[model samples]
Target: MNPALPLARLGRATLDALAAIGQVTLFALSALSHLVRPPFYLREFGQQVMQVGWFSLPVVGMTALFTGGALALQIYAGGARFNAEAVVPQIVAIGMARELGPVMAGLMVAARVASSIAAELGTMKVTEQIDALTTLSTHPVKYLAVPRLLAATLAMPVLVAVADAIGIMGGWLVGTTRLGFNSAAYLKNTTDFLQAWDIGSGLVKGAVFGFIVALMGCWFGMNSARGAQGVGRATKGAVVAASVLILAANYVLTELFFSA
Candidate 1:
């Protein structure tokens, strides 16, 4: 057993991870630099907005709604042991506004939008369309990546806001119907306990998550290998990377926003 082998493997993995991080950072910077350049693709931007935002609403809404309802039930059950069941509405609202709403929406968008972007761009790369665009004097990053990055970043906050509302409504519904709570009182408690900062923080998290999702997709897609298997791998990598980054970013943002 060569003791140096394990250390060597660890060092190699660390270097590989660092290199990947550097590459992604450079890719993101390149795409962002193209945002202010001329020949803006309004049509592409509009299509991406619709694709990433509007089409994502239903999934975001449903996820939030179910999560809120389940959260209320769990809180109520837990609070029962302490005779604090009356705190269900408040807790549900705070949880959804501060964490679940934005995180859930981000993961959902990462799964849907990130994979789609990666697959589409990977296909374009495989088919040489990206090269064709470059030959025609078009900057592929500007035409292909910038619109998606911009759209996702702008749309995520809106989706988080909508998710928060639906989630709170879900808690309200569950509280009033199943928990035998008064509707007016539940609504009042939810609104009274949820501060503007809570909602605002979640929206900000949403925006960051959205940017991360798009960035991962574009990076993987553009760097994908030259084959169908490579495109599939890129799509999978985009979703996985976006999801992990979303979770990691959520923790960082939560710490920054809520740490004393």
Candidate 2:
């Protein structure tokens, strides 16, 4: 193996990554611009809000509840080792409000909504429906991408707020029923420990993650290759990209919000 060959391959990969970023950034900007200049599709936007928000509630709630419970148990177990088991309520509230609730909700939405949007749009692309829209004088990005993107961005914060409440309640339930803590005291500790900024930061993270999810789906689908296998790949790529970006963005936002 030639040393120069590996360097060439690394350079190619770096260029490819940069090209992808540029393409995605342009796509997002186009969709955003369309949002303000529209024969506004109120019906499409409403449908997407339901699809991305209301239908996503059950999965987000379930994930938050179970995660909150497990977190409480783990915190209690670890804290017990230090004779600090009483910290369970406070820790769970902070963890769920500041981190787990938003991250888990974002991931769940990425898995469900991103994949669905990619598949739907990919199928439309493969079937020439997008071309039909163009011929009929409708901008596909405005009709399809804007609704989904705007809906997700607006809806995710609401979902995250619900997740945070359910998550805190889950901790309370576990602490009271399984961990031998007084319910009222657990609630008080949680409320006392969780700051308004923590929850607000998580909601902001949720909105960003939602935008990323829809952007990945729309970008991959619109650029999908022309075949069934291509659509499949686009769907997979959308979910993977959305999920990774959510995690990465989560860290960046956390650093900005909480760093000393």
- Please, what's the RMSD in Å of model 2? 1.0
User: What's the residue-level lDDT of 125 in candidate 2?
Assistant: 97
Q: Where does candidate 2 have its weakest 10-residue lDDT segment?
A: 186-195
Model 1: per-residue Cα lDDT at residue 66? 98
- How many clashing residue pairs, candidate 2? 0
* TM-scores for the candidates: 0.97, 0.98
Kindly list the per-residue Cα lDDT of model 2 for residues 176-200, writing each as its tens digit: 9999999889988888888899899
Number of clashes recorded per candidate: 0, 0
Model 2 residue runs over 4 Å out of place are: 1-3
lDDT of 1 by residue, 170-216 (tens): 99889999999999999888888889999999999999999999999
Q: Name the candidate that leads on lDDT.
A: 1
